[model samples]
Target: MPKKDQGLGPSAETPLPGDDTVVCGVVRHLGGDYLLAKCMDGVDRKVRIPGKLRKRVWINEGDIILVGLWDFSPDKGEVVYKYGRNEINKLIEKGFLSKEFINALSEYL
Candidate 1:
């Protein structure tokens, strides 16, 4: 049997990104090596994980992440941040992330 708290996974306090530099997005699909994300602003963008994050973060479809948009094109971006379960719950409680997103996240968990 699994422990009650064990299902919550590991806890890490990675800081959430500033809205000016990065926006929160939900990973909708994986197009080959790229991630198709729909941002909170209602824009669907193609995102690639930068080399620095590639070695450290593990992203999958339906995960909520932060993406820094490209300067030249509005339709592309880079995944700069990953939100852990604890961080996500905090975001929901703090009103940074919408309640609907949390509902969707619960389906996955």
Candidate 2:
């Protein structure tokens, strides 16, 4: 299979059963390979977009996402949330996010 067409698979990156966990954050940086987001769980976690999953998801910095992961550290958790548009939109429109924040989120989509 072509590298470009290689969709995010089950083998991409899995945060054991206890790394870290949360569901929202601020985009801090868009790295050469992955994204760096400020987790809302009060844990300063630097996220990474797994090799096979980066291009497949519409993940942007500053966008809030529903995360599901294990304990990565005392202040950070590994990411498992990839494509959660509906969830983000609902939270944004429900007054959890500002217009500017939502706009920023769109840039990644």
Candidate 3:
């Protein structure tokens, strides 16, 4: 059978479609103790990248990043692959995200 399309990139600070299996979306909203994000699989999942990610990287909203995949019940997505500041910067420079919103998964390179 042919493989299903992964869909278009996150244009306009949209959540990533959970499919890459390895990649995960960046922080779309951060308020509560944990952060809310749309995973690469397109699943909006909660992540824990506060202490480390926050301090290390200036994680603004809408950042397409690689993340570690974690499973715990029917609802839950944890951050496993945390990119550093430099990497995050590269993502920004790539311009896959919105400059204004600065929140998106990917864009046509």
Which candidate number would show the highest lDDT if scored against the true structure?
1
Evaluated at residue 94, the lDDT of candidate 2 is 57
Candidate 3 at 91: error in angstroms?
Answer: 10
- Model 1 CA lDDT for position 27: 50
Candidate 1 per-residue lDDT over residues 1-109, each given as its tens digit: 8645422234455556574445555556565547777666767788887776765567877678888878888788888778877777887777777878556545544
Q: Arrange candidates by lDDT, highest first: which order?
A: 1, 2, 3
Best first by TM-score, ranked: 1, 2, 3
Give per-model TM-scores: 0.69, 0.48, 0.45
Q: What is every candidate's alpha-carbon RMSD to the true fold?
A: 7.8, 7.1, 13.0
Show the lowest summed lDDT stretch of 10 residues, model 3. Answer: 8-17
Model 2 weakest lDDT span, ten residues long: 11-20
Q: What lDDT tens digits, residue by residue, belong to model 2 across residues 1-109?
A: 5446443544434322223345556466546654555444445456655544555656666656545444434444345655344555655555554556455445644
lDDT of 2 at 68: 48
Looking at candidate 1, the ten consecutive residues that score lowest on lDDT are 3-12
The clash tally of candidate 1 reads: 0
Per-residue lDDT, model 2, residue 36, is 56
Off by over 4 Å in 1: 1-14, 17-19, 22-32, 102-109
Evaluate residue 84 in candidate 3 and report its C-alpha lDDT on the 0 to 100 scale: 46
Q: Give one digit per residue, the lDDT tens place, for model 3 in 31-94.
A: 6535666654457676666454454455555555555455544345555444544554655576
